[model samples]
Target: MSNYSRFSRRRFLTTAAASGIGAVFLKGCLGNPPEPVGTAVTEQVEAAEISPEMMPETTKVVLGYIPIVEAAPLIVAKEKGFFAKYGMTDVEISKQANWASARDNVTIGSEGGGIDGGQWQMPMPHLISEGIITNGNKVPMYLLAQLITQGNGIAIAGKNQGKGLGLDISNAAEFVKNYAKTEGRKFKAAHTFPNVNQDFWIRYWFAAGGVDPDKDIDLLAVPPPETVQGMRNGTMDAFSTGDPWPYRIIAEDIGFMAALTAEIWKFHPEEYLAIRADWVDKNPKATKALLKGLMEAQQWIDGVNNTEAVVSIVAGRNYFNVPEDILVPPYKGDYKMGDGKAEIKDKMMGPLYWKDGIGNVSYPYKSHDLWFLTESMRWGFHKDAISDIDTAKQIIDRVNREDLWKEAATEAGFTADIPASTSRGVEKFFDGKTFDPQNPEAYLNSLEIKNV
Candidate 1:
């Protein structure tokens, strides 16, 4: 084990002893907390045990997710015997290096053999839609379930940090423009993928600030866990990632959170439980079973007490590999990135169980996909890629298996009355102007920067 891990374990035990609380990972430099005297079972453990027969009888299913708190439901389901209760034994969960690795694993494992499903950053399927990555290799992917919704925050380090640095201002939008002009330096922020929620959020936030992210910011693809290290290493000035990292940074007093993704747009969607097309084709029944398990886990995690258990479980070394204190939500109904400075909240980020199944695995809303595509194009990831809006929509439609999700959700007891058609809801950012998802042409046209 690395020095960090050793230190963390020692710290974890000490904290537990004093508070009688379960262990929580507190990465990004927490010293230590008083030890609790006794071990305590999280509320999740106490939830009435589920029987193995309650779930479908499926063989082993290999699952992949990045090491982040958003993937907690999967862990909870597995650890708490939800998977076993549902008749799924030999369920394997592995942490991939990054989003690209996770997506590739889904494609290859689904095609070659038994890689059941993989969790993906919310915008990845959309990227395949815009023909942004690996052309023709973009296999049709399906959304079995929506995992966690909003879970990211924008973190800014001190001025002593390297490139992409911006001043702290209450009005995040104005801060970007003035920082760009006065600093005469391109601001940098790390995100796990160029086509994910954080990617879209950074671009949208900048746009709202009157500074075009496409023109002003240099966004890089860095995995979530590595972001703070990047900031500490002076390779990045700020970064946007979900959970723990920002809170971890603040707990250690390394930096301040500039904004939360929910601030950019309340009810913003983030990650999903995505599977490659072929996998869905081969194991359709298994897919439904997996969705049921996930839905149950989602509902469990949403309970206030269960949320506390989630923080403890995901913080373990086997999962997120961070100290538990770092994973705790800093505020009630909100998240603080740095020292409780900035907070954002929305209904979407909350737990979403089967609203009676039909609404379970809904298709990716056009607006949600568009924002990421626009960001990829805006930030230069889509160079020479398909620029036509119609083509983008087709790509999105092919991969987003909302229909499949509906079936699974219905089976899981989720509501089936979700609007059959996608909505072109206006994209509201902190700056106030709305980007209409339905009117992509006009939205793109209105932008001051080059679309291509």
Candidate 2:
């Protein structure tokens, strides 16, 4: 039996009509004028009081999702009703056409059921803050929660068959040393959004290897779904995107694994569920409830036994729409190119689970934002950029909603004291270096590839 099974409309009417005073109280709760006299006033009042907590029933939230395996937690959340356990009854996951539509549906959608929020790629939060997306509206948003730390890998066309550039070699740096190299010499790279995680990762990776990505590579904005085809047609040289695309490319022998973004900044931050800053401010309670449900959903998706179950549900005809084989392929780092002679091993694919996974979901630490911001400037977003401290604080204050996150954390049974200031906890990047937000200039100066 379900909780709603005993949630009778008649019982509610009985309570609402117990007295004239009770009727008035119910009316106040309902916030409306009386309906037609023939229609039961008490019944209308009860129907109007149907909040998820009040009914312990359906709580539907519309989410914007791209048809990819990274959306598995959302799929599991919907199918297993993890959301319901958190006082959310109905949760709707809508497959979006692409990252742009997914983003716009939230920032620009009218009341008729747009995305409440969904998985947003990194650097996007910065792009959004910089007013780079559709409408140019500086609709500042908050990352109330994270979905995964990292789920992207770089791939190179296997047909090139030259072992391409190696991560360990300095010679690889010259592949795209100048924009002219890709002119009639087009060395294509694909990203879902021009300023998204794929773009940021590729740019930073090349920069770390001593190459200026913006001036060297001919970047093509292709959907993740088309990345493999783009590579196969020789329209792209390499691309960095979230899974199934990387795995699918390897499985088809069209591309070889270049490197994982996590390798760049191990356990690097990836995707998050961001909300408009005004929305978080106006509806703190609703925002908390939504994050609580998402936290529950993430936990469910990361449970050991639930991996197969998640893959099965997300790959359904209406979800990711990919075959099961491609959906649940082993993530233990075995790269299979066409010749069956090349193999790379590493711990790769992961769904967000707070404090549990290798790259656990955490508050968008300020250092992470700084790293991306520096990269953005290195590639050019801020001209004569402000002090790293001021910019980082501004971005952290605007892009991460700590108050709302702490509220949701309390409801979700997490007890850590949410930091009261913009200061991020200690951060360690891949080169065995640490960044202290309290003093960021020294850290920025230490990086091998600081912005111009």
Candidate 3:
């Protein structure tokens, strides 16, 4: 094991015990599974009590999160008293082992010792609603709000540094295509989960460069730690994952970032905050209360002044369990791309919660949901579930609940930030490909290397 990994594990065990945060073993993951940890809230802030009519049906909730930047808002809401301020005093932020564990846990819901809902990748709510990734048992869900934007990217192994593995790999596409012939194995790559945000990012990057992702490379889902170890041992060549991991690669000299999702599509939609529709329906007031808390946390984290505090709170052993320095660069938008690529130093390039270059990041824009489904179609993922554009639109309409986000924002006195439209309009990617929500079919047809 790498020294960093060993140190992190020791720190996790020591701090988790000292802090009195209950840590449970998580089964079924690569390597030894780290004990599942939850929020250890400190210093509760006093706020005005909710009116009798506005009081939530329930004050408690269990939300799942992976220890990544996308999960900052959820963790912050719990740690900084934002949830309690909004009348959600019993909120629990549970750490998930991996995306698959999250999926399985959510399948059983909170009553069954699982999460009610929490941070999620694009289209997962839709897929779970339609029973695509849920073992064919539909669990209706609502896409409440987007958790974050940017903070994700593609990483290339250090061994492949100078072979045209940057953002635009068109110049060395042949090098990637001929890996099997020369190296005696297919160029291996991985994402956190299949048919999700990370998977889509890598697929788009590969297809844009005239390299067929399916034919030219071996792409599969692997946990982030294993992915990093694979890169170190020269077993994995590339990875598409969220913040901290990508930065860890560069800090440990294991790999260099090929591109940020921010560069892939500036201020692009990343992960989301979604919940079971049954949960939302049963406790509408509580649902709004959760959104209000998340809104406060999101707005708080966006302030440049709070970067250090944000890093400190979320990097605790009970939370992300990563080194503070590893998170500092990405949170400050100070990425060192290595491999002769220019370094990026724009604050907006980091994870943004409430707003970004275009508009409100907290709003669950229906247009962004359309793009995920359209991209899924491009790769022919879950074709039986999302057979066509019309089917995808129906799913989006059912899953995305922008109206609830607006209600929560307005109630929280954030009326000014609510977007006027559900769509963010046409989005342009790094490779010059544009996805127009109005013409998703045209967008799909425009792709040169797709199963569809």
Candidate 4:
């Protein structure tokens, strides 16, 4: 924990965007069998060298993470000695002040006194691959894996007295759109960064209901950890982010969850494991080792009877800093909407983790990246260029390392059930919209409100 640093809301930088990422992992996997399970998250595993000569070149590696349950896999990997088991002896988990710091540090890389790899948004790696964002020293990044799927990622109608649920969101969009049209003003909403997955989720939902997110609403950048306080102080009307905050908002009675991103897109890929591309190119084996460890943690997190322990581990002061009780409900699949509505505990709404050692909720899918790139273009990210599928494919092909995760899963014994294809075909949204990865431009044209 020596790598940990204290964060302040005062240090947040603003940018906004995000996207659904990932395809799926194997049906079984491409391996033999996994090792036995450990009890505690901090329990160290007995070291077993993968090969007599294959040792990680870097003994210690620094990774940045926002202190949230979404970052659980990374923390769990370190705590459970998976990193050590996979040859990364000195894995340091550093705390970031906010998404801005995370983006900055990851961009700089360890060579520039920044992070080597960390849990990041799905769209960031795409931005990095396209050179829209870069290391302070100009190093690109690789999207190695999509760590987790969807869970309450988009919860609009959280502000402005909007009904927090149902198909009436069009009304709120109308209200905001009408406000913008008549009064020449915008309703303010909050997000963790200027452009993150949260922002895209917010924008997509608004656009689906006939509102132009860019013009009708003011999207404010509030750090995820502080978003609840921002809402409490009326700094924002609504916001969406990873766990604790969503449930925390409901618990605090400041707002209600409008729509869970899971409901929007049942299997929306939320976060990714990204690192400096140059470092990864130099240390592919080390990168694979880290992926192997994180995959192990992913299996543990979604295993049956493991939610409580995971909640406790991440809720620790060193992690999310939230109390255990607040995390229990979400871990248990009960999302209290806080609008006098019943708790939603559907498995899809819960953290999309590997349950009972079987599930592809965390695989880094090329199709997921493809969808994300399309959304990136729609929101004006390098809109003049790189919006087309060919450019997006080039960036994704260059950055997305689904093959690494597959190799890691195979080596880690997730075998006999590897996904036949890296693409998951066309995925449908709650609004009856479907994104066919092969034809992303069609999906882009299908949308009524977009940047281009």
Candidate 5:
């Protein structure tokens, strides 16, 4: 007998009414809500056809996620029954306090009251695998898939508005470079974490305009909420982070967006879905099941008419815990860039999951991993671990699990969506710099400002 079978209808109703959850109890008793139109029915059919042998090795796993737009697919998979559809009924999507807490938790593993794995910043899995960020305690992780593209940017405090702090800070590079001489301190900036995606974005923006990130400004790792408060108090000059934190900056009148990551590098890789390698090796079938659920959730979020539903689910109290209105604009690609800048209203310039301008957003491309490591080398981050291009390639080969993504895609009947190669080919940035996976050295040498 099931757990629900132990509850008599009369007793259940009485208890629910006493707790003021009568409506919720009735809804649960009626079964799941009706599926949406289009692909949902087909997805239901596919899930219904999953045989006994195809079931996952385990039904329970704890996953951690920060409350950013990048974590939408993980949240959607849990809320929309995607995980359950794949035989992962007890999957838990735990909310992480911040990136630091996430790192600390994953270091302990789920059995120790930490998470198995979930969303992560670029190259974190690789860094963790090599023990670069974990203080020499290597926690080998697999880069399962890319969670999102774009939906991030650099936000400037209101006081610095109209100081040429826009996307191209070339005209105002000297003003930023000379802050210490004039203001008696270096211009302050912050990112959510150090030497990762957010840090790289702000650093790239500064370096592109001839401002040395190391010498021209003071960049540090600060949490989003604290960063916002600092901006309001005129202590933080700028910050790099993902939505809806950046969106909140504009909504609350604290600052204006300097540049969207979309403009910096269109359809650039953002966060990812990665898991501990030990957990994955112990439960291979369960890993694939998790991928299939995430793939379905990604497709569901990419639907043209499902933006409102996406916002409603992710912005709930259990997830992002933010207002739906704040998330809606970015989902629609309707950015109201303040500081007298023109608005960006293109749908393609927002957060994308399954696919983007270059194609196959979910596929964990090895070339992308190489770029992150290469960027790390450029900044001399973890110089001893990621020594050179060859070392970076070796790390990419060891950590990037594109083969797993392919297998899961085939099992999920999404083979057609898979890319022909691991490399996305040559990538172009807004500053007219190109990174060809074939020759990363050339790209690094072409840069005007770099540590290496």
Candidate 6:
């Protein structure tokens, strides 16, 4: 049964009464002032009773989401009452139409009756901070928390599954590179966004194999949900994106799993919980409360035992809307790559919400942001992507909310999991490349292929 099953029959009746499902059963008119029916009773809360520390400075918080499982922490918190527990009584987890829309909406904010914050791409906060995404009319955004890391899967053509391939993508890229040069046809790979982490994974995959992602093959920015069909229709030779899509490729035998992104760069921080900086500054307590609830929801999701229920919740109409079967395999650590190579999911692929979860992920890790900034530069995604490591750190620090994460985590008693240092310390990519946060310039110079 779902968490909603635990609600009492009386509570259900009251909710149903308001919703017009049970007008016959309701003793009074739907609009009539009601008494408390149960815990939380109706949506309204008593402002006098709410301690200032416990309440958001403003009760109305509109959080936008993309309906992917990367949104688990946010969705789970709202569904499980973590938001309410933190005294953010009026919360809206609005479904987003696309990444561009989510960014634009959150950038504008509830002042325009738009979203105040949301599950935005990781690079966005930095971009926003630099006034890149917003241009001169910048709306400063902050990374409140990271959502999920390494929940993405890479799928290659079934024909090329084991054709000169080891576990790494080097072999595939080599084949594609040679094919592209001789045939003048570049293999196309679809990702959700350019300059976003998904595109980073795609570029990194090809480049690891000595194929220039910028020149050798076409990288198309297709929506995540459309990737499977894009592959099926031969629009792309391979596709990479968040879970369920790659799982769809695997189950349907259309393509083979190349590597989970985490395999490429273990627990590469992806999606984030971000909000307008003004919102954070205005509602410090509410911000902490948001983190507190999400932290708890993440803990709940970290348990593999909860995978099915987690899938059920996320796969419903309001979320991923993908079938539960498609969602189950990846969540349960099973992978049947279309190439007849089946491997259990790598827990390190995190499939992770917490930095301590399933071998983990990170937040406002200045080094992590440094890497993202470098990747964006590599692709020429940001016209003026910062090349200076020191300046990058300053920019990241300006937008990052590690202090907020610390306050919430410590108050929630998760201090034990906090790392002694903010940096995950020089990350190693699957291509055998190391990124030293101290020397981002050297790291960028080491790359053999880059648009920049």
lDDT per residue, candidate 4, 1-452, as tens digits? 11113211121110001111221111212121111112234344565445634455564677777766778888788766667676675676766666666666666566666678788877876676555765323447788777777755544444455343343377556666565565455666777765668888887777888777777778777765466666676555668677877777777777777767777777678888898888888887788889888878888888768888787767776666678998888766688776565678665567766531234766777898888778888888767547578988888788888888788778778875456788878888878888998788788888888877
Q: List the residue pairs that clash in candidate 6.
A: none
- Minimal lDDT window, size 10, model 2: 21-30
Native RMSD of candidate 5 (Å):
7.5
TM-score of 5: 0.90
| lDDT of candidates 1 onward, in order | 0.57, 0.58, 0.85, 0.68, 0.84, 0.69
How would you order the candidates by lDDT, starting with the best? 3, 5, 6, 4, 2, 1
Model 4 Cα RMSD, Å? 10.9
| lDDT (Cα, tens digit) per residue for candidate 2, span 263-294 | 66666677777766665565665666667656
Which tens-of-lDDT digit does each residue in 61-146 have in candidate 5?
Answer: 87878889999998788767676666675677766767776777788887876778889998899998999988999999989999
What's the candidate order when arranged by decreasing TM-score? 3, 5, 4, 6, 2, 1
Evaluate candidate 6 by giving its C-alpha RMSD to the native, one decimal.
7.8
- Per-candidate TM-scores read 0.75, 0.77, 0.93, 0.85, 0.90, 0.84
Which has the better lDDT: candidate 4, or candidate 5?
5
The stretch of ten residues in a row with the least summed lDDT in candidate 4 is 11-20
Which candidate achieves the best TM-score against the true structure?
3
- For this target, which candidate reaches the highest lDDT against the unseen true structure? 3
**Root-mean-square deviation of Cα positions for candidate 3 versus the true structure, in angstroms:** 7.8
Model 2, which residues run further than 4 Å from truth? 1-60, 110-113, 175-184, 330-352, 356-362, 382-388, 416-435, 447-451
lDDT digits (tens) for residues 1-452 of candidate 3:
54322223332233322233764535634333233355555544455356666677887787888889999999887777777676676777777777877777778888877878888998898999999988798999999989999999899999898898888889989999999898789999999989999999999999898889989899999988899999999999999999998888998999999999898889999999999999999998899989998998999999979999899989977787788999988999999998989999999998899889899999999999999999998898998888998998999999998999999888888999999999999999888889889998888888899998
Stronger candidate by lDDT (1 vs 2): 2
Looking at model 5, residue 78 earns an lDDT score of 72
Worst 10 contiguous positions by lDDT, candidate 3: 4-13
Indicate the residue-level lDDT of 310 in model 5: 92
